[model samples]
Target: MTSFTRPFILAAALATLPLTALADPSVAPAKDSLEIDEPGGVPAGYVLKWSDEFDKPGLPDPKLWAYDTKANKHGWANEERQYYSLARRENSRVEDGQLIIEARKEDLKNKPDWGGQHYTSARLLSKNSYQYGYIEVRAQLPCGLGVWPAIWQLPTTDHMMWPDDGEIDIMEYVGWDQDTIYHTVHTGLYNHVKHTQKGVLKHMPAVCGQWHTYSLTWTPDEIREGIDGRDYFRFVNEHTGKGAWPFDRPNHLILNLAVGGTFGGKTGVDDSTMPWQFRIDYVRVYQKPE
Candidate 1:
């Protein structure tokens, strides 16, 4: 599912450390510096378009964003370990021009719990949806065992059923090799079963603790993923019916910080690590032109 977008974070700096942590179940959340919409400026005709400045300090802005509560009860193919709530302070926050999403190893208020996991945090998505456009977000990811941070998109029509509906992982990291990041695409044809891999593994000069421009350029011709404005992976649709790339449909935006599950165990979540933060500077969307 190209779903699960989360905001709320700070600016990250170049840091070199082992990707996984040794389970600290009690480490307090770290502070970050993700300056929100600080006049990054826009290209002419590209338009400022849309964004979540996150300048206010509190819950996510009701008008521009909402939560995918389904994740709290188990959503996405990963079956991760966090319960996503709407605009919850414990999950998301804004301070000093940055938005933060802190996932912690703690019990939740599981009322009508749908087999929810022991982790707690936030997941946010853009209230609006689009099919073809250029979407970009500058952010600093969280680092800790079992920590999974991402910047991606999902169907706008709400593909209630995944796989059949399709899921795209623009950027998904499992905290194992903090130096490496991934960008994957999930579709009906080559899904969790086929063991197909359609992505680019970017080995950043440093881990995600540093601020960088991560984005996607989508058009009728192709879907490309990039970091720092450099294209590393791309996929295109073929009407001839050879390869399968079904990402032309409308999709919404998502930013999230997940804990642990199938993809995270390569290192393992350090449950002892409490309150890990994801800092975001700003999110900007641009239309390629009609």
Candidate 2:
């Protein structure tokens, strides 16, 4: 989940917010922006703050989602071969009550933004940001070599600068390593580059063919990662300094299916799996009342 490159540009509107406003994750959005529907099964003490069921049949709701194509032209941080398309339905679309992020074997040399990549896929960022909250996503993974799917969060700041700003990888999976999943946290003092990241690995045999819920519960005290309501990993706040604990500030969500990256392509891509679909059922975030 630690991209070798710096974070890409987020929404222009988010970048213009005052630092004070951006720093406070407790600052609520307009009440009307809270929910599309009152989601059920929420924990007793937490209230549903935001959600996207992907019930609408079309591109993801623009108000709730934005594309990440800034790194495509120069290739992605991990030498990913996919050219993440911008607002292209072929790469990302909603249908049959699911968000389908498809990775296809193709070239977009004709497009002005095409980055000379052999594959095309999608990377989406949540328009909203959160501080301490419980975030969950239900989805079925795509299988076969070279497929890299991830659900993660990054600092929501225009000045975001890699590990220093911190990253929370709620879930990450590579095709070659079927049924295995990873949950990791990166900060200035701990990261993969330094071989000191806080991470967990789990094996779930039904990971690719079944729908599973991956989640992150974050608080001022610690961050926990879980699958199907069962917690398997936890990173506690040491209260040492920002270098070790930067989760106090707001971070936005990210959903992407990358193909042929430094990690995903360790065994090379399988062309037969030309069009692989990464299906997402829903994304919901909840926060305890202050």
Candidate 3:
């Protein structure tokens, strides 16, 4: 039952935001940028709220992870190719002080198989939800022409339904864009439609298969996305209005690795590709005094 729906084209105006392209030679496909960028960390005053150090090695931490077996096809933005299964080892597991979401290159001839995608991986979601604050997750990405890994959060409001329920894709990458990373937000305004807005940051640094701490700081005033402490993009909630600021509720976390789909086609995926994996050192969250 897990399937992918058509991608909603984001509005050209939102794509035009200054971060549309990252031009740093270190992270960008080619070096090009004028502003001098500096490094930053968890904003001052924020304290460690919650964390999963991955101390054990057999099945994921029950306190933090749960199987997402929803049968309805996920919009699966960007041509990502992945099918999430409930009890399959190929899809997820905890190992060696870390979490692994394995992506296999083969034919999936079973349940929830979209039919076309031959790769299987895990998309684990946190049953726990945090209302608002700074969230930090440290993990190394799996890099290959077709590998896609992400550490993001979503609203707990299944009651409101999707889109309106909202989603925050803090860190998402397709194997092809090895060095560069993408941070996105999907609300009612930009939920899988041609009229959505998105901001992309490029030319940061290498994050594939290496440890890097990714963070998201959400406040009533703004939403900021950072990599290893350095901020790449900020969305001003006040300037964007309520439609773009539906992040006012508790949002859960998700860690997943996907293969070629929408953005996957650009990089191309060969079923002969053997196996790929997504590694997570641990996940931690923080909340400031309310």
Which candidate wins on TM-score? 2
TM-score winner between 2 and 3, please give it. Answer: 2
Q: Candidate 3: where is the Cα deviation over 4 Å?
A: 1-39, 72-80, 107-117, 160-162, 190-192, 239-241
Candidate 2 yields a Cα-based lDDT of 0.77
Model 1 regions lying over 4 Å from their true place: 1-45, 71-77, 110-116, 241-243
Clashing pairs in 3: 1-112, 8-192, 22-202, 27-203, 28-203, 79-261, 79-262, 79-263, 81-259, 91-122
The lDDT of each candidate is 0.62, 0.77, 0.62
Model 1: per-residue Cα lDDT over 1-290, one tens digit each: 12223332111110111111211111221122111221222334564456777788777677777765653443433446677666668888888788898887777665465445677877777776766667888888876777888777766552233444445666766676678767666555544354453555667756757888787777666667777766666666655342366665667787888777566655677876667899988888876444
Candidate 2: list runs displaced more than 4 Å: 1-43
lDDT of 2 at 41: 36
Candidate 3 per-residue lDDT over residues 25-80, each given as its tens digit: 11231112112234656777777766788888777876667765442144243444
lDDT (tens digit, per residue) of candidate 2 on 1-290? 11122333465433332211111111222222111112323457987788999989999999889888776666676667888898999999999999999999999999887879989999888887887778999999998898888898888777766677788888888888887887777777876555566767777885886899999888888888888877777788999999988887778898999887667777899989779899999999888875
Clashing pairs in 2: none
Please give the RMSD to the true structure for each candidate, in Å.
10.4, 9.8, 8.3
TM-score quality measure for candidate 3:
0.78
